[model samples]
Structures are given as structure tokens and as C-alpha cells.
Target: MTSDPQQDWQRWHERRTAQVSAPHGPLSLTGTYWLADHPDGHIPGVPGVWREEGDAVVLTATTEDGITVDGKPLTGDVRLGADHTPIPESRVATGDRRLVVLRREGLWAVRDFDPEAPTRHVFTGIEATPYDPRWVLPGTFRPYEEPHSVRVENADGRERGLGLSGELAFMLEGAEHTLQVAVEADGSLWAVFADATSGHGSYRFRFLRPAAPAADGSVTVDFNRALLPPCAFAAHFICPLPPPGNTLPFAVAAGERNVLAG
Candidate 1:
């Protein structure tokens, strides 16, 4: 890889903007309907009858409903598991809108992603700070004796378990800082965090993803790539909030500030 941080950051920023503005991206999400809320299987503006059955969602539609399954017209009931594919490839669709099934902590929900959503059309771009070498610092990852989960409020006002596998420690302005991090399946480290800038100069909270630690537990804690949570782009996403100890006491004047005003 090239050693030019500025060039790399510009490419990353461009890719991030393209991804966010793409059809079926976070901006396209319109609604997240929990199956339990509508026991009668009649979603407010959705055309199909949807109900939870065992571990799958059963959707029933008629030809008049004009719903499609795997690109074919859906005329009868079909059992669908949670969609693991991208939004555009979701199994169910109504016109240009994709219907995505989601299961979280045993609760099932359906998401509507429309390519022509108003939010997607109105998106200007993400507002991010220029790459600064000062924000990139050496860090150490210390794994916990045992992974744990903490209860935290989600963007949707629900409390759920947020899992943590370790802590990333680094120094900023001669002060030591730490953030609880989750170990992803790909060996990356994910952190949900907030700082003094949060809810003030920046979004309420942001996400940090660092590469997996080295064999010696050394890592680079780069704040220049801080990300706006998915909820920042759409109101329907249920992103988790920062955990108790992940809030930094000082302002972090780096990374993404917010989505550009439309």
C-alpha cells in the first residue's frame, strides 16, 4: 500500500460518499417495522401481509399486490430468513423498493429500502475533516480475560446488549485514553464512541474501526476515519449508542463531523 496518508484518505472519503449515495444504501432506508407491533401482519404502507413464524418471516402477497420475490412476482406465501445480502439483492421487492427482513436479539423487523427515497435524492455529501497526521497515534490492545456484553440504549430507544472483547489504549495531548472495542469476525476492532464534540460540533456519536492488533498487541488508533453511524443517514436504522466507558472526556476535533445539509 502507498504510504501517502492524504492520498489514501481522499480515496477513502470518495468511496464512502459513493457508497452512502448509492441506491439501497443507508439513505434509502424508509421504514423499520417490527413484526410484533403489527400482529395482524398488515404494515401501514407496505402492500403485503407479513408475520413471524418460528425463526423466519412469512410473507403473503397477491398478484394485485405487485410484490416480487427473487425478481419473480410473489402470488403466495413464502418463508424468508433474515436477509444477509445487500439491500439491492434482498429477496422481496415492491416496484423499486426492497423489503429486507432483519432479526435482532430474537425480535424480527422488516426494513423498506427505496431507491427513490427522498433522503437519498436530497443527500449532498458527508462532511469530514481533512486527514491530519496528529490524530494518528500508536495504541495497544488488551484483550479481556473474557468477553462481555453491556446494556446500552440504541438509536431507536431500545436497550440491547453491546458486546466488547477488549480495550484500545492510546495517548492524545499527553493524556491517556481508552475505548472499549468489539472484535469482529474478520479480526478488525470496532468501537462506538462519543466525545465532547458529539452532539455539539459533530454527530451525537461516531464509529471507529481499526485493523486487528499485531502479534505484540500493537495497533494504530486513527481518529481521522471516524464514521457517522448508519442512523445518521436514515432515521430508521437501529445503531447502538456508545457504551458507558467509551465516552472520551475531551473534544475530538477530527474525522467526520456530520452529513452535509441538503
Candidate 2:
């Protein structure tokens, strides 16, 4: 971390804008078709027969359907696993659209990322507040004996398990506060939270990803970098809502507020 937090924030904000407006970015997502919802194997607006078979998704298409697998035109059935690669490098694509296979909690789905999506074209930029030093606070992470999952409503109105690994405690306005956080594979901490400003001055909810804590459990809880979740850009996303007690009583007037409109 550099001593000039404003410069660092400006760079982060620029990178975030570029990424979200990219060809295959969240704004470009047109749909997330769950195979279980389409029993007949036909996904709306997507040309292919998709079915879940054990651990892989079976996609049957023809060259006439204009679908390609691994950059080659497809003419037969191809089993695909969850796409972990970047959207541009997905194994399935058709023209300028990428079909990303997704698996979560034993259910399978496919996301359609079209470069020509209307949302991507109309996106102006993100509405973010300028860096403020007050939003940066000292915090601590207290890990649990064993991680647990909590059922939370998603942006798509579905319920899903939100795994929680610990709590991040910090002080603001002379009061102590805490939020339930999940431990990422990379040792970072993630939180889905909201505040008084949410749905008023900012998006409905936001995400906070803090770096790994030190041996003493000390970390920086910087609201200056709070982010608008993917759902803020596209309705197809199923971002999890804030869990119980994750909502702060006060307003947070920092970080990315919303997607700028044209």
C-alpha cells in the first residue's frame, strides 16, 4: 500500500470502470439460464440443447446454430464443466457471445455474455465518491471454530447458502461494529453489507473485500473501496444480499455508489 491513498483509489476506480464495461463484463451478461428451469433442454434466446449430466453439462448443437466450442465451430454434443477461465477465454462461444457454464450447489447453469448487450453499450461509468480518510478504520478478524453457511436471498429472488468463516470488527463514530465475513481461498475476507445510504445514496447493497489479516488479526476496513456488486450492473446476476446484522446503522458515503446513467 502506498502513502498516497487518493492516487491508489483513482487507479482502482479507473480499472474497475474498464473491467465492468469490457466486452464480456457483467454489463454484457444477457441471461443466466438454469438447466433445471428448462426441462426440455431449450434455453431461451440461446441456440443449443443444454442438459446437466452428473458433473458436466451436455450441450448439443450444430454448425447451423452458430455455436462454437473451444474456438471451433460445433456440430455435435460436447460435455462442458464449470468455466473457471476468464469470460473471453471461455470454451463455448458463438460469434461475439460467450456461453459460460456454471455449477453451484449441484445445480448447473449457463450465462450468456454478449458483447452487443444493451447494458454494456449504455454504460457511462460508475458513480464513486472521492477518497476520504475518515472511512479508513482499523479492524480485526476473529475466525470461527468451524465455518458455517447461512441461507440468504439473492438478487434474483432465490435462496442460497452464504458461507461465513468469521467476523470483522471495527469502530466508527466511536462505536464498535461488526460484520460477518467469508474467507476466500486466497486468504482474503469478503462481506456483503448495506448501510443507511444503501438504496438511497448508493446501490441496494455493496461488497467489501479486505486483505488477509496479520498474525495479530489486525486489518484495514476501508469503506473508500467498497464496491457495487455485479447485480448492480445486470439483473441476470444472483448476488447474495447482506446476511443478518450485516447492515450498519449509519450511512456510508464512500466508495462506488452506483452505475452511472447516460
lDDT of 1 by residue, 1-262 (tens): 4699999999999999999989989999999999999999999889999999998999999999999999999998999999989888899999989999999999999999988889999899999999999999999999999999999999999999999999999998888899999999999999999999999989999999999999999999989999999999998999999999999998888898899856
lDDT of 1: 0.94
Clashing pairs in 1: none
Candidate that would win on lDDT = 2
Model 1 spans with C-alpha error above 4 angstroms:
none
- Model 1 earns a TM-score of 0.97
Worst 10 residues of 2 by lDDT: 1-10
Model 2: clashing residue pairs? none
Q: lDDT of all predictions, in order shown?
A: 0.94, 0.95
What are the candidates' C-alpha RMSDs? 1.0, 0.9
lDDT of 2 by residue, 1-262 (tens): 5789999999999999999999999999999999999999999899989998888999999877999998888999999999999999999998999999998889999999999999999999999999999999999999999999999999999999999999999998789999999999899999999999999989999999999999999999999999999999999999999999999999999999999968
Candidate 2 lDDT for residue 44: 88
